[model samples]
Target chain A: MAVLNMVSALNQAFGGEMERDPSVVVLGEDVGRDGGVFRVTEGLLDRFGADRVVDTPLAEMAIAGMAVGMALNGLRPVAEIQFMGFSYLTLSTMISHASRMRNRTRSGMHVPMVMRMPYGAGVKALEHHSESMEALFVQVPGLKVVVPSTPREAKGLLISSIRDPDPVVFLEPTRSYRLMKEEVEEESFTIPLGEARQVREGDDITVVGWGAMMPLIEKAVGSVGKKGIECDVLDLRTLSPMDSTAVLSSVRKTGRCVIVQEAPRNCGVAAELIARINEGALLSLEAPVERVTAPDIVVPLPQGEGHYYITPGRIENAIERVANF
Target chain B: MLIDDYDPLKKRMLQVLDQEGKVVNPSLEPVLDPDVLMRAYRTMVLARQIDDKAVILQRQGRLGAYPPNRGQEAASLGPAMAIGKDDWLVWAFRELAGLLWKGLDPLRLYLYWMGNEEGSHYPPGLKVLPAVIPVGSQLPIAVGMAYASMIRREGTVTLSYCGDGATSAGDFHEALNSAGTFRTPNVFVIQNNQWAISMPRNRQTAAPTLAQKAVAYGFPGIMVDGNDVLAMYMATQEAVGRARRGEGPTLIEAYTYRMGNHTTSDDAKKYRLEEELKEWEKRDPLVRLKAYLMNRGMLDERQEETILGEAKEETERIVVEAERFPRPTVDDVFKHTYAQMPRTLTEQLERCRRLEGGGR
Candidate 1:
């Protein structure tokens, strides 16, 4: 075991998988020599030559499209888009081709590839750098959307994603890359996709969130614990084939739920969670589900991000409202 | 090199056989095997027959909207004939001639236009991708396949086709740039069929030739007489050979004309003049190839009639086969979504079954 941050954990996963499977390759702009803009791919070029670690031209569409081709040709390609904002360029392939290759071909062919992009806002970054739009990818069928909260979750879930039989949109938390360190397994370990992890268990209310929102939800849960309003925090590691059973079970026990997200309030993952809760555990609910999310507006630039970004206070307020109701 | 000789920048297009079926460039004309030549001619004939029947079927409400490959048969078949059996063919829609040449069942093509997903389920070892409706999107995938080939030390090359309109797409430019940057074994054939729906070639880009676009991406690009099967075959053969030798990608602009509407939904008479269509008809690819074969005494009037009759019979049989193909089941719609269907999808499938009045 080794203490590592999210970036290091993900890098370890890539290294482990690439070493185990020769068909695994890493490709993206600055991924080879520059070691990625975030340096997550640092040392991979030297470790696994240029053939395995390719630095492609700065084209997001081709990066994603090429990964699909590589996957079709029996290579497990882990392609990176510089940021989530730039990831829209890839939606053309992700939607039209990557996501539907298996279904379109009726199992004749499938793209076993992973597209990784750092998402969410926190650090003062340039425009289009900080975006938490997991909802956009979740809405796309035939795609597995995964978000990892901590270093351990990042390493395990990334490995699982790389090994998955279909295309996966692996959105890493930008703010959590180095925000905290945890003792992660040095060797390969896999946390299965579509399973939720119970972070803090209680009975008063069920608090559900993912990626960058986990730490905020945990902090809120910690603050609310002092007021005797215990919370059951669920980390939705995988967003698409979400662990709704875990949420429903927890909601059934708590009878009240609070969903938190960093994305805009409209049509976000929280709304999807609320709908699932309504369908599965509506009769058990003692109070209406409360959603804590960013306002429906363009994610403000760094200067004005404080007003638009989700905070622990907002999560705590929602948890209190659900508990009191 | 053919690419060096017909530099797209010089606006010089390579033409082996002229519109009159005369050998315009004797030295550049490829000497193909007798069997290969016959197969190429047969595939082109069948494509044209299928194209005609598809339009009739759509008109009769038997099939859905279908793209016609009327005049550009040679442009699609020639490059397809040049590649090896193992080579990948990533095609945009409307490459019926190429798909047929690559061993795709005509029934699958008919089934695809008839709105069946099973149409895309190609038989094993047929290394052709399904029809990409979104223009220029398949190019990047082709590049990636070539890139993978390079990494695996596989000598396989990927040949992808796009239209004149697809050249204006960002994916087109990005695919070429990446292919050039990686020096992948790729052959990008632009079927410049003149019309992207209503937009003319002149309005697509200011570049003098679509082939020249490859020059900006650090590779050789050539313009070929698309109607001349010999020219397209010779140019693509050279490009495929260069790619196999690891000389990197080559872009070929198959300068052809869309002799028919973009799809059955379109009408060419609305935006194009009759004089233009009439002029292109005189340079029709099938007519030119047939003339060349007849001039060489390789094909006679009786043989031509027999080939046409066979094509008609085969197309008729395929239409029945496609129409009779099984309708998709609820399980078919849900099963292939994932390798292992997740619990959520399973539940949804069960729900769909329940709603359909089937409890099982």
Candidate 2:
């Protein structure tokens, strides 16, 4: 086991996959010499050379479309959109083509590619840089949206995402990239998408989080656990093909639920999760599922993000209210 | 052969053969073996016939909405012929001529307009992507494929076809920029058909020529008389060769005109002038190519009739085959999102199946 953060774990996953599959190629702005904006792809250029490790221009749409084409023509390309904020231009290609390639073609042709971008707020980033648009892509036809909560899960899920015979929008948590280190497996392993990782077990309530919100949910769990509140903390590894069984089973056992998200509250992934829970385990629930999410407004500047970002206190409070209800 | 100092704003349109059925620049003309020349002419004839048949199909309510590629046969087929079998065709809307030239089953294209997902399906190793509906979107994907080809040392060139209007898209700029910056194997042939739906070419860009925009991306951007099949073919061949030798990408703006409405849904007569349409009709791709071939003694009246007859026969047969394709199931909509249908889709598929009277 190696103590690694999300960035290193992601880099290791890239290296491991590239080594395992020659068809795997990495492309993005500064992915080669600059080693990515946060060094997430550090030292890959030297190891793999210019061919495998491509440094693309400031073109997110090209990054995505090009990756899809590469996937179309045998190469399994891993494209990096420097930040999730600039992903709007690329979304047309992703949703219209990459996401719909498999279903639209229906002739066994699929885009076996991964578009990796660091998402979310709390690191005091710029306007577009702090967005969490997981909910937007979930509705896309053939896309699998994966967001890892920790370094270990990041490595495992990425391996699986790369290997999966479909397009995946792998959202990396910018705040969590170097936030902390965890014991990650040295050998490459794919933690299949659509499977939930229940970080902590409890019988009273079910707590869910993903990406940057996982740490907040974990902190809230810690805060509540100290006061004798037992809960099952589940890290939703993949949001598209959600781990409904894990969520439904946990909600059934716990009888109370709370979903945390960095995106807007109106139509967040939390809302979808709540809908699924209501449909699948409504009778088993003792109380209504509470959602701790950002307001349905555009993300504020660094000055006001501290108030808008989901905190452990809010999650803890929501848990207590739901647990007591 | 790479135009090292191409000025995008210049009005330097490359024309190998003039409309008078004469080779204006014999030195620039490719060594057109009789067989290759005949095939090129045949493909153009087929393209026009297929497009004309589609317009009829649309009127008869047999086909869905179609953007007819009536006057732009040369622009597509020329470049489509230039690239090798290994290269990929990242096509935009209205590129049936190119797809057919590249061996995409003509019936599948007709099936595509008939609202079948299977229409986008190409045989393995065909390397032709599904027709991108969104304008200018496929350009970047072509760059990416070329990027992959270069990285793998596969020596494959990617020829992306788009209309004159696609040049204004940010992805178009991005695609050109990356290909220029990376020195990847890419050739973008913008069919400057003078109109992007209702918006004319002048409204699309302030730049004098669409090809000049390629200069901004640090690459050669050449404007070719798109109606001149030989000129377009020569330009694309040069571009393909440059890309294979790791020289760089080229943007060939095929200056042509769209002789039809944007689609079955659009009323072109309401916006476009009849005079402009008539003037462009004189430089028709098929007529020019046929006349040039006849003057060169490669095609006579009998051969011309045979070609037209064959294209008509093929178009009629493809329409019959296209209509025979079974209707797609509602269940197919839920599948193909992932490798195996995920748990959510699995449940949804079951629901849809039940709705379709599966009973279980």
TM-score of chain A of each: 0.99, 0.98
Give the Å error, residue B145, model 2: 0.7
Number of the top-ranking candidate, with TM-score as the measure? 1
**Positional deviation of residue B272's Cα in model 1 after best superposition, in angstroms:** 0.5
Q: Candidate 1: lDDT over CA atoms?
A: 0.93
Query: Residues B46-152, candidate 1, lDDT per residue (tens digit)?
Result: 99999999999999999999889999999999999899899999999889998998999999999989998989999978899998998899999999999999888
Cα lDDT for residue B352, candidate 1 = 96
TM-score of chain B taken alone, every candidate = 0.98, 0.97
In model 2 chain B, where is the ten-residue run with the lowest total lDDT? Answer: B1-10
* iRMSD values, candidates in order: 0.6, 1.3
Worst 10 residues of 2 chain A by lDDT: A100-109
Candidate 2, superposed: residue stretches over 4 Å from native: B1-10, B358-360
Name the regions of candidate 1 deviating beyond 4 angstroms: B358-360
Candidate 2 lDDT, A56-172, residue by residue in tens: 777788888889888987899899999888888788999888988887778457899999999998989877889988888888878889999889999999999999888999999
lDDT of 2 by residue, B1-360 (tens): 535433456577788889877999678878979999999999988989999999999999999999999999998989998988889888898777788889988898899899988887778888888888788888888887888788778888999998888888887888888889889899999999999999999999888898888878887889888999898898899999999999889999999999999998999999989999999999998889988899989999998899899999999999999999887877666665666888788888888788779575
